[model samples]
Target chain A: MHVDINSYFATLLQQENPALRGRPVGILKDVGRTCVIAASKEAKKLGVGTGTSAYEAKRLAPEIVFLPAEFARYLDATKRLKKIFSNLVPDYEIFSLDEAFLNLTDCTRLYPDAQEFGRHVQQLIKDDLGEFVTSNVGISWNRFLAKMAGEIAPKGSVAEITAENIDHYFATTEFKDVCGIGRRLEKRLAHLGVTRLYDLHFVTDEQLETEFGPYWSKELRKMSEGKEPSLFAHHAKNEQPKSVSRSITGFSLAKDEAEIRAVMRNLIDEVMYKAREMQLSGRWAAVSLSGEGQHWWSHQRVDMPIRHAQELFDILYHQLYSQWDRTFNVIRWRVVLSDLGSWETTPEPWLPDWQRQEKLEQAAQELNKRFGLFTVRSGVLLQRPLIRPEVTGYLGDRQYVLGP
Target chain B: MYQTIHESIEVAGVFTPGKFSPTKFRWGKKTFAVEAITLLSRERDGLVPIHHYSVVASGTVFRLSFHPDNLAWFLEEVWQEGA
Candidate 1:
């Protein structure tokens, strides 16, 4: 079963403010950002949606009200929603902030009828969350079909796809409706004169391999038959991250070395803080900069675990920034730490100087934790507007916050 | 339209074991009676948790936040008919 909140962020705002209810609304990532991250159902009907520019959205629906995203509200609601869902369905996977998948194999006795179960869950959400916030539930034998069913289901309704009705849905649905088939894949499939899932019957296996390569060819065949080979693989919870990265676009382009260095220091601070929070260390570090229609990126493998911001910054500084031509103003900066391994499992330090630095890092982390992040930041970040930590719309690091 | 007014304010409210609801608050020279608390959410700054209350009052929506560490109330924002 796949349950997805309808217009999650925008609907939550509507639920919060009575005046916003029944009106078109667009959600922005921040006050200054122009991209509409999410749109209320009313706004979507008028052609305003995610990725729609604020200017375009205003033109599409002049009466639309815009609100900056309140991630705290959404995350709080998700925590409560998860509590309600876990109580009823133990075997569940959080697909995103507003979506979840439940494996009802063990709960069949408790929920004999999946459709009834879906409705019961919806009622619980309405009762615990507000009346304006609604979810669409879809049930099927696999996650892929269940997600598709949920997409087709009406807002605040339940849908189920069985083996008998699978073919009917495949014939009626377009290739784009499938979860894994993106626009690029759709165009590729269309080039071969395949418009629907049912059209895969006409194309030979060799042809699919030639177009989609070997791995996706097998996946596509399974998708055409409404089967998901790795349906259970996504259920793995509390999995440590393989890599950690943080990137930010400057409010205005940085024209000099001082500005670029400050931004890099801030980004590295964030990356290292996250790594420390996860109790992980990286063997690889990368830095990338973008501006003036040109991009520069470099990465290197370090001899020791990249545990500190200063350490990673030193490597990136020598490789990328020191060699920079300074021809164009940089508009964005990104720092990445990959090849992660458990810091807790690593052997104890043997060098006195290294041990002293480690203790200093620990003390600094402790102070920052109590006073707030960046309270003990490097002097380079002083007097600068602290970027602080932020939650991504994708909720990619959900496992670090919520356990299985 | 909406306006951001992150100013400290005086508020009358009900405070129970686990509930904190503001009934009325004074901003500038006017006191607005909260008709309804439409939503409540909590966010963290460093280690301090700030609780926000979205309320309807005087034909407008107001976002009020409470700082537990300082036991202070702030009028964060207000939304009216137009800019």
Candidate 2:
């Protein structure tokens, strides 16, 4: 069964802050637009959850504690927890930072039942890690149903979502609550009057085929029937970020528009220069600005194709200042390059030619090699830097995120 | 502990310029700066941070170990590198 730890990050914050005990809390990431990634169990009891925006969470629970994410710390903690899991369950798959699954179907004799096995895991995590990690273990025939069971169960509780309760789980849940289901699919599924899992389960194969196409119709039916593809499995070192991003906080709310633009520019130049030096590019660039009283603004690259680092930076640099101007003091700024596209120097049809593109790439390389990545930068990026000699890049020639 | 890591960093350039790595941590989160950002459009292999005359004297290390928390974080990474 899947063991789901609700609001693991929020729980960590609450546990660390004695003052935040029993209070609603939200986790903040550099992606300021992503209101809330996780909320504390207390917040959930108040009907706040994963999709709850930070603004909404703040409105609901005015006393909510906002915690910035420190991914490195969480990674360290997860490793410690995983070590305990390896010792206890010979076969366990870490699903995410806060969840995992133990194949207890074979080890039924190890505990009285799945619930006891789950209890043992919960206690083990809390005791070993010295953190209160309440896990909801779902016992089912397979990994998919088991994970669903864990998710639907009450906090610090366990329930088996078998043929019996599977109906209840789907009936009471939204499309997104179903793992592997996304919004577009849900809306598409709705077109066939299959708005609920029961609707999908009861739909004839032909009707499903008519709606989702031949291949996916049966797949949707299988999912509705409480079956899933597979459990989270360990892979080689391939699970990593396609690109890296860096952002910072701390600017006056009174900074002028030009001053704000300069800061954004410095940040852009640093990231672009480093990305260029590293020979990496992404399909989407995430730019975010956070200000006083929990105000956060984010703009994804809408104009550029986001195929390369320079392109991503160019989009972010132009858009942020043009939009925010000097209206708000930049409490923080972040840049994330994601959706790593193909890494090749194919000739652009618009500006096609090996020589021209190579010439541009070569110029950037030479400037970086001579003066370090920061030595010579685009004038667009050198506008700001009220803060002298700012921090830049994971190291000399790279941005971070794909995990060094 | 401070002196140990300080030693692994190699100084380069004519005028006590920047530093280069004399040792590299070879595992898990201890990333090679080269492999850190797989999508940043870097044209080179890795980075050599320019410490700058101002930052060095500005006490980068002093600021790092300024508090017990920072010291603990630094020492742990340093220790983890070897272990």
Candidate 3:
């Protein structure tokens, strides 16, 4: 089963304000910014959708209301929605803030009727969330088919896809209707005269493998048959991160070597702080520099675990500076710490001053946690003010206050 | 349109035992009995926790916010008919 909230961000704003209900609304990260992140159904009817600039949206609907994106509220609503699902279904995967997939094969015995169960869940979401918030529930044998059904389902309704009706569903559905088939993939498939979901059945596996790799070819074949691989059945938690990176843009571009080094140092500190917070140490650090049409990167693997920002910076600073071209006018840089392992698994420090340095670092972290971030900072960081973190979503950068 | 009004106001409401939802509130010298709670959400301003309430009263809708740190109440916004 797949459940998706319709125009989730916009709907939440409307649910909170009665004046916004039934009105064209657009949610923005900043009202002063032109980009529209999400648009209400009314705005969509006026040809204003996500990624539409505020100017374009206003040109389409002159009376459209613009509201700043409130991710905290959206996260709270998602938690409530997850609680509602937990009471009915045991296993589910949250695909995004507005969509979730449930494995109802084991729980269907409780309700007996899958369609009725989907409808009940939809009603519960609407009643518990708000009258303005509605969800489309899809019932199918697999996650891909279920998600497709949800996309094609009418607003505030349910659509069920079974072996009996899947053929009919595919006959009218386009390739874009299926998940994972974005514009790039659609254009690639269109070049091979495959535009509809039914055309996937006619394409040979060898032809698919030629365009996509063997792994994706097999995955597409399974999706064509409304079946997902067994690996996707369970929802895994607490998976280790493959890499930790921190990069910043939208600031004054670096014009000199000092500015470039400062940016790199700041990014390294953020990534290292995150690593220490997670109690993980990395063996490899990579730095990427990008400017007006040029990009350069350098990577080095250390024999010892790199746990401190200064140590990681010392390694990358030499590699990055040696390759730096004075003409590029660097605008952005990224620091990535990879090949991570738990701190317990890494070797301990053996230097004469290592213990004193470790205690000093711990004290700084404690002071930052109690007072605020960067309350105590290295002298190098005093050259530039720390960049304000921007909100993305539940998984995005978060702003925390120190005291109650 | 949502407007920002940060003035502090007086609120008279019932605080039941073990229940945090306010049954009614008086603002602008007009008393409104909360017919239904449309939404209840919590957010923060710096270090202060703010509780927001969307409620329906006498066919009109009101948005209220309470700051527990200093026991402050604010009538954030009101949506009257045809406005």
For A51-102, candidate 1 gives per-residue lDDT tens digits of: 9999999999999998888888898788778888889877788878898888
Ranking by DockQ: 1, 3, 2
Off by more than 4 A, model 3: A229-235, A246-277, A284-303, A306-335, A350-404, B7-10, B14-19, B23-37, B44-50, B54-83
Pick out the ten consecutive residues of candidate 2 chain A with the lowest summed lDDT. A390-399
TM-score of chain B of each: 0.91, 0.15, 0.75
Best by DockQ: 1
DockQ values of all predictions: 0.62, 0.03, 0.31
Whole-model lDDT, model 1: 0.85
Model 1, span B1-83: residue lDDT tens: 56889999989999899888889999989999999888888776568888889888997899999998999999998887666
Best by lDDT: 1
DockQ category of candidate 3: acceptable
TM-score of chain A of each: 0.95, 0.60, 0.82
For residues A211-233, could you state the per-residue lDDT of candidate 3 as single tens digits?
Answer: 88887788777877777744354
The better candidate by lDDT, 2 or 3, is 3
Q: What is model 1's DockQ versus the real complex?
A: 0.62
Candidate 2 CAPRI classification by DockQ: incorrect
In candidate 3, the residue pairs with backbone N, CA or C atoms under 3 Å apart (3 or more residues apart, or in different chains) clash, namely none
Model 2 agreement with the true structure over A154-179: per-residue lDDT tens digits: 78887887676677778777776677
Runs in model 2 lying further than 4 Å from the true structure: A29-37, A50-55, A70-72, A105-112, A163-176, A214-218, A229-404, B1-83
